[model samples]
Target: MVSQVVWAQVRSKAGRLVERPVRELRGERLEEYEAVWQPPRYQGRRAIATWWRPADRARHVGCAHLGALGAAVSLEADRDVVAFASWPMRLHWADDAGGYVPDFFVRLADGRVRLLVCRPAGGSPQRWEAAAELLEAAGKQADWQVHVHEGTADPVVFSNLQRLSRWRHTRLADADTARVLRKVFAEPQPLAVGVRESGLPELPTVAKAHHLIWTRKLLIDWSSPYMPHRSLVWAPEGVV
Candidate 1:
């Protein structure tokens, strides 16, 4: 509660320096984008994607880039981000040469704007810290909360999450099959064993499990590789 009051005070201080949304730009930056590059590119891949969130996700783009690291970052965005954009936001200061456009503009669960830059371990460039300082100052002036994401999660965990994310949209068509799988998962055990002992058709049973994991009705160790023969999962409310 104290933190909420503090944030409110900060927002009050910001006092509408800029009226536009964070993702939109006016004047010089818009002109350069419209008349010059047309679209931003990272490793020949223009930043674009439909977000995973259900509320008007189709109309909102979530990220942009074309590389392995970019792909990993995009996955993290879909799984963990509340909302985001790729190179669509910029911040300019009066004395600076020009505006600064970071790699990503992320809105986290806490209502803080994160200027995310994905870089290799031990390879951070000096410009990032400079931009971070500038953006922080801008936020402070406006009484908005801003954060800089300079580090990444564990690679193994990232890869594991990526693999499981493939099943995020999976669903089961057969009601009976889904029921059986739910019963099987009600008691935590290896999925392969559940399929075998339940005497349900292996193919269909496994498909329903994918849906469960996707919906988070079934929880697994997202930080480790999914062991098809041995990952443990169960229903919510400490059922496992």
Candidate 2:
């Protein structure tokens, strides 16, 4: 009862200070079903399909990358693990599933699950911190291991590294740190192969150069291999 009262007070105070609906800019809508990249690179329906869709080749490839990383590090470690991306968490309302979700979900061979929250570096720090706290609180009641990864130097490996940073090497049971090292430091081959096989390399000059991949309903155009662009917003109605 005391804890609930304290939480209510905290929530009331937070509501007074935090911004309600945070918005990020994508690109101008060219038509009802299309969005032209203001600069032509990672803004259209294709780009969204490529990076955001769970079934997209790139997204699956990322999962493989995480798994491979875990497997590789297991060779010299004492842990058994499996890793994947976009493992959505069911949000609960008063006791049922709520719409809020967490990003990555990792499971150990023994069945323990960990919820990972990853935020790209260039995002609003305040919101990122708030999100981390929210996930942590949710984990406390849900019995899942919770973690947050912050984007730093490269967006490509942002979440991988941020979550890896939590371990206190001194407290790690083994020097290998299987989970940490595997996730944040995996090889780039899997991603490259999947991207090429997706016909990303055979597309037209503009599409290829912009990293656009065609999907049944949309196009994911304009992605960068370098810095992270955690800044993304949903498309408007009638605009892809």
Candidate 3:
């Protein structure tokens, strides 16, 4: 079956609209899009405009709703994501059916680009499925990845991510304390035990430990409920 052609429109940094065929977008051009794109303001019931500062990037990202904000938090927690922007572009069908503004554009550490759509769980799955089809087709043509993220399936994990994000800022990191943590958690141990064994002052060491976990220098069972004293923590393989 022949795939439908897709085109993208984005606002440039100077506030000019620029349109291009999806097939033509790749490499350095993606960065240009990120630099220029701005998220649209949302209005009406449950609509909100908010900003998030990701640990991996120095700038604040705008989110259009709670779901988009959650998606941004998930992106921030992902170790593989190098950078991301919300509402980066609008995808239009060449046939002029309509257009969609995807919720996020992500640049991964392995040099892959992804387009993301955010929807609350229990929303119209059929509608989002159709949107995913169009976006995925565009992604294929552009050599990009695509996803439609429903609301958090695991509240435990999402809660844990939120907790860790509080410590995600680089300002919380202590190199000396991190080194001690890496060795102390070289073997799997409870969170409080590892922090205490670091031999630093309790308060600061605990914060640094959480920061390391946020940065993925320390690994935890994200699937499990987080506990300050009981949750297990360990360094990734070969870290010690």
Candidate 4:
């Protein structure tokens, strides 16, 4: 038996409503949907709506809750994620029996689109399984990837990402300092040593190093807790 095709309802940046079959969603039309779809405001008492501005994107991405915010943080730090938006569209079955709004729509460096759903830690996964399956089916029709983020498993990694995110702004980047730091860590070295070796002002150099790490120009063991003086830092592959 042939499964029913899914439908997508999207709002343009100019506030226009568009509805179409998921298979027909591509090219310019898909770009329009990703560029302008805004997430509905959160009204519940528990989770607060928030906004996050990533260095890679010009506009702030709205997040419905902290778990979504965390997912955004991880996306910002990902080198492959070229762009993303929140709640970019709604999906429904052919008969419109039910619908879902995904947490994020991501554009990868290789030109792939992804739909992400965030379920915070401690939330029951079973509750979202059915909806996720539906979203997955819709995504498959649209040739987009689908995933559900269940919060970070490692508190230390989450804490590290949160700390590094503070330095994610482009203002902290310095080409000369980055070059020097990358050279200093061509081999594995302590975070303090590389920063000191940059031969720049101590405070500014430290911030730049953290920024480079956040951008993945300088690599660190994400599984390890970040430390100012002790954590090992190194250049990524292909960096001399």
Pairing residues by index, what is the TM-score of model 2? 0.32
lDDT of 4 by residue, 135-216 (tens): 7788777788888888878988898999999999899888988888878899998989877776778988998989999888
How many pairs of residues in model 2 come into backbone collision?
13
Q: What are the per-residue Cα lDDT tens digits for candidate 3 across 199-234?
A: 789898888888888888889999998898888899
Residue-wise lDDT of candidate 1 within 58-95, one digit each (tens)? 33333333332444344343546565554444555544
Per-prediction TM-score, please? 0.59, 0.32, 0.81, 0.83
Q: Candidate 3 — which pairs collide?
A: none
Weakest ten-residue segment in model 2 by summed lDDT: 22-31
lDDT of 1 at 107: 61
Collision pairs in model 1: 14-142, 47-64
Candidate number of the best lDDT: 3
Give, for candidate 4, the lowest lDDT window spanning 10 residues: 28-37
Candidate with best TM-score: 4
Off by over 4 Å in 4: 28-44, 120-130, 186-189, 236-240
lDDT (CA) per prediction: 0.51, 0.31, 0.79, 0.79
CA lDDT, candidate 2, residue 4? 17
TM-score winner between 1 and 4, please give it.
Answer: 4
Supply candidate 4's per-residue lDDT for 57. 56
